[model samples]
Target: MTQIEENLFSEFWDKLNGATGKGFGKTVSIDQDIEFYQELKYNNGVFAAFKVHRMQNDMAARLLDENGELKSFKQWLNDVQTIADHQVEQWFRTEYDTAVERAHLAAEWRQFEREAGVLPNLEWIESTSVTPGKDHKIFWGVIRPIMDGFWNRHKPGDRWGCKCGLRATDKKPTPVSDLPAGESDEPAAGLDNNPAADGKLFSDSHPYFTDHYGSKKNILLESDKLMTKYSREEVRKHFQKELKGKSLMLQASQGLAKTISVSHQDIKTITGKPHKYNYMKNTCCYWLPQLLKKAEYMGWSPDMKGTAVPGHGDVKNWHYYRFPLNNEDSFLVVKERMNGEFRIHAIQDKEHFKENKLKNPFEKR
Candidate 1:
């Protein structure tokens, strides 16, 4: 990843899992017509960006060698294509599905809010959540008139993972004067409109775009398609032509003792973020080269049994290494391809290491 992706947007690269999915659910996938209609599915299974970089910058950075030389295109492409065969499927069916589902659900409810606009009053109903936001509960049962601008902004689903909604009621409207302090006065950033009023399935303020790439968020989202576009030979040509780098040794880790190939899919295993494996962010990419140079070897283990990869051979053996990230106690496991090179197996946390008795690096495996 480039310094811009690695540092300026490290949050998108380093810790995207924890706080993403905001501003997302306000719009459910729906098409506008003479009458509003929806089928409850994503706009497309793939999130395509009409404007995209096509792996010119951030991806090109990954091709650079230890000496700051760019690796031959053939080398970088082989590295990218060697990544896990089925990682994209797991993410789309799970994470992307959840995001679109939330957006659909929220948009569905907003339709109710818009239809109820003719009613004199719509009451705010704040529901429970495992992860709650600042003030949804404070306005619980708040009945404001339909014409109040407050109704146009600030609904329950306005916040990420929020379960708030507006209820239709003809009861006496709560006076604006009754709000305590500054409560319910301003809509949160990016959530200033009703999705039902606007015909988009997502609010423009979605953090998937705002917090990460701003207007260019779609570049990252369209990646699942990017991963399946090339073969090892083809992609190497891509890297060679695109990067115009020098020849590559059999292994990029010449002076280093051991090397592990970190693929785009392997990244999601570390952060649990839903992006497809087309590129790497430097935040986690640093671990790989570092592991090759200075990490303690933790030996091999039987590859976890799972569904067979459809078109790829399964690795029966796996290798592990322990390295320090800031202060995190973690292990990087590499999978062996029967006829190919070594690729990452998993990036597990301290608790996972403890459960398997791999926490102490000096402890014999």
Candidate 2:
């Protein structure tokens, strides 16, 4: 990694230390609270480092064209990289602030809920203190129970960079017609859960960890191990080993569709990085394995990139599969090519398939 990327990793790691109150290269004091919090800090730090690495690669990819020709320096600048950075910054900012807010609000909130629980007629409006996107602004002035299911999911800090908070009021609670009942009302993949109530600062479904180096479970495990080992250098070594040209041959789970197999190099087609795919996330530096293993079959068609007689053994065909991840609007659609060798792409989900001409290319009826 370059010095700039190393700096990014350290900057994020230090920022997260505020949450767990653990010093770098220090032993856990054996205090349960500090230990638990310290583990969370390590988890967030490793995830942060993974993304910083992914972002740098994506930015570098923008420097070249599909034909392998160099692009102008100005053209190398892309919006997706910025969006990636913004999400990372927002995720970190919210995580750090949520930790602080929970500490400050815990005692007062418990006492308030204890007294307020006695009253059957209390409601709260979710007011956004910061300007939010249409997705969140739509909930402005919307009322839900002060301490109920809605608050658990729609509470302040629910979205990355969300500043929405509940304002307790005497007004009666009313349901919004536009609101869909369970399942459909979930927030974005990583933003749905409440850290204050659940003590999980990051969602398990966030693409960062879901597709992170060594996988989510492994990453968390490594993060926990880091707390005990207290070696930042070792942390980087383990993370790097699991990622970057690891020559992995991953397979999809058996189901209605034929099992699919992908290698680390095929993933490089989307971003010059072997670990990542250019899906809703930067790419599947690690999540590609999970996406393939968990994916449900969509459909198949003749490969548009090559000519093949229908039903003939030309060995040119396109296989399609859809896997739900992150959010309702951001499903990952995988397209694989078969002709002795193999290639695939995790592109935009169902909503964008048509606009991108990604929907079942030359599908056989």
* Model 1 alpha-carbon drift over 4 Å, by segment: 1-35, 38-60, 65-67, 71-118, 180-192, 207-365
For residue 13, give model 2's deviation from the true position in Å: 2.5
lDDT of each: 0.44, 0.48
Candidates' TM-scores? 0.37, 0.40
lDDT of 2 at 316: 54
As a TM-score, model 2 comes out at 0.40
* Candidate 2 steric clashes: 7
Instruction: Give the per-residue lDDT of model 1 (tens digit) for 1-365.
Output: 21122222222211222212342333222122111221111122122221123223424556877889889998877665523222234422343333443454444455545666466677876665666566667778888776676655556655545666566678888787875343554654444545445433344454333544333544544433332222222334444464344322123232222444554444434444222222221133323454445555665654455346541356755566665543345566666666545666555555555336333433332
- Candidate 2 structure quality by residue, lDDT tens digits, 90-129: 6566667654543323322333454565543233334445
